[model samples]
Target chain A: MSNTFLIILFVLIGGGLFLSFLRLILGRKATDRAVALDTTTLITTGFLVLVAFLQGRSMLLDVALVYSVLSFLGVLAIARYLDGGLR
Target chain B: MSFMNILAHVVTGLGALVLFASGLGVFRMPDVFNKMHAGTKATTLGSVLFLFGLGLFEPSWLPKLFLIILFIVLTNPVSSHALARAAHNEPSEKPDNLIIDDLEESKGGDQ
Candidate 1:
């Protein structure tokens, strides 16, 4: 039953990811693309957590945590660059 | 197989649906700001729900899942706000529709 749940979870996340890719392709402007990418990263983090559960591994949580932090910092860096300064 | 596991799966499935809807909103919204609003807010909430469900399904990693949720709630808004401000600051080719220009007034010493 856990395996069945895992399969369904994977399918759902995969569908969400496919939709996000479509957004990246069809987005009209730079900000629109950035927003889509940001959403994608968040979904990826969730996907990783689900994978960790399916694999019965505690270590994957650490990876998910680090990815979450790094992605947030990356978005901030990009926003700063767009804003013309670190300030 | 257990009732609790089934409940967890249901929560995760709902979260994924929310994430998919947010993605569609990103593509369908009329403008950048609206897309940002939809994507950032909905995805963050959806992800938190997903992680929470995962934590319930895996009892050993509950602490880590809580930390992930904490990090998400804190960072998502900050980054989204920064992105929106950056987009707003970029000069557009067309004049924006405005009834009042407070920044312009302050610049001209019209206090």
Candidate 2:
């Protein structure tokens, strides 16, 4: 049953990631791409956490935690740069 | 599968479905603010739901899962807010279908 759930999740996240890529490619504004990138990082974090659950490794959750924090910083930096809020 | 396991499956599945819808919104939304609205809100909730589902499967992991979810909830809106402000000020990408330029008006400049 869990295996079936895993397969279903894989398909769902995969489709989401694909859509994010499409938006990133077709986006006219940098902010649109930023939003897409943010979504992609989120999906990746969820994927990492799922992998940790499947593999029975607690350390991978830490990786997901770090990845999320760093991605937030990345988005903030990009936003700051775009807004001329940075010196 | 037991009822508990079924519940986990249902919750996680819904989370993933929400993430997919967020991506679709990003692809189809007309402007930056709309896209940010869809992306941040849905994805934040979806990720929290996903973590909560996993915590249900293994009670031992619940604390850490909650921590992660809390961080996401706090940061997602903030980052989106910053990005929206930036997008509004961007010189090259004029927002299509913009209804109000309150920020522009407040700036009191022709920028």
Candidate 3:
């Protein structure tokens, strides 16, 4: 039963990722693309958590946690650059 | 047979739906600011729901999931706000009917 639930969660995360890719392809503005990328990162974090559960590995969550922090900082840096405030 | 399991599934399903809608909004919104709003708010909440559901399903992962949720709530809005401010600063061909120029006024001089 847990395996079945995990499978369903995988499908959901996969589908969300595909949709985020579509957004990345269709976005015309720089900010739009940035937002899409941010969403993609968030979805990836969720995906990692699901994988951790499937593998029964507690250590994977550590990686996901680090990724979440790094991605957030990345987005902030990009935003600052785009605003011409990076100096 | 377990109510918690049923609730977890429901929450996960809802989170997926939220994420899907956020993606659509990112593609369909008319302006960068609107798209950022949609993507940041919806996807952050969706991810939180997803992680919470996973924690419910796997009790052993409760601590990690809660931490993920906390980080998301802390960072999502800050990043989005920064993105929106950045977009506002960059020059763009305005839409035909845009009437307000608050940012322009704040700039104190026309570029």
Candidate 4:
């Protein structure tokens, strides 16, 4: 049962990541790509947590935590740059 | 499987599904603000649900999961807001659908 659940999860998340990447490539505007990038990072964070659970290694959760923080900062920086507010 | 195990599976599965929908929205939305709406709200909810489900599987990880959820909830809106403001400020990507853009008028007057 757990194995089946894991398979389903991997497929779903992989599909999501693929779609986000597609948007990043096909997006016409900078903000469109930025939104896609944000979604990709968030899904990746969830993927990391799922992997941590599968491995029984609590330490990987810390990595997921840090990744989320960094992604937030990245998005903020990107937004500032796009707004021309960053000098 | 036990009750908690089954519950975790359901919760986590739902989270993954929500995430997939968010991705679809990001890809399919016609405008940047619409994409941000989908990307930010659904991603935050989906990740929080996923983390909560994981915590159910390993009770010891609850505290850290809660911390992550809290941080995401707090920061996702701020980042998205920044992005939306930036998009609005950029003259190249002004939203085409708005009938009454109060911000533009105010900002225009101030300038």
Badly placed stretches (over 4 Å) of model 2 are A85-87, B109-111
DockQ score of each predicted structure, in the order shown: 0.68, 0.79, 0.67, 0.84
Q: Residue pairs in steric clash, candidate 3?
A: none
The candidates, ranked best first by lDDT, are 4, 2, 3, 1
Candidate 3 residue lDDT tens string, B1-111: 789989988887788778767777776778777777778888888988888877887888898789889999999999998887788767772233447877777786665
CA displacement after TM-score superposition, residue B74 of candidate 1 (Å):
0.8
Residue B12, model 2: lDDT of 87
Order the numbered candidates by DockQ, best leading: 4, 2, 1, 3
Candidate 2: how large is its RMSD? 1.7
lDDT of each: 0.79, 0.86, 0.81, 0.91
Q: What TM-score would each prediction reach against the true structure?
A: 0.85, 0.93, 0.88, 0.95
Candidate 2 lDDT over residue span B7-56, tens digit each:
98889899888888888887888888888888899899889988888878
1 or 3, which is superior by TM-score?
3
Model 2, C-alpha of B91: deviation from truth (Å): 3.1
lDDT of 4 by residue, B1-111 (tens): 799988988898899998998999999999999998899989989988888988898999999999999999999999999999999989997778987889999999997
Ranking of predictions according to TM-score? 4, 2, 3, 1
How do the residues A56-77 of candidate 4 rate in per-residue lDDT, one tens digit apiece? 9999989999999999999999
- Which residue pairs in candidate 2 collide? none
Q: Which CAPRI tier for candidate 3?
A: medium
lDDT of 3: 0.81
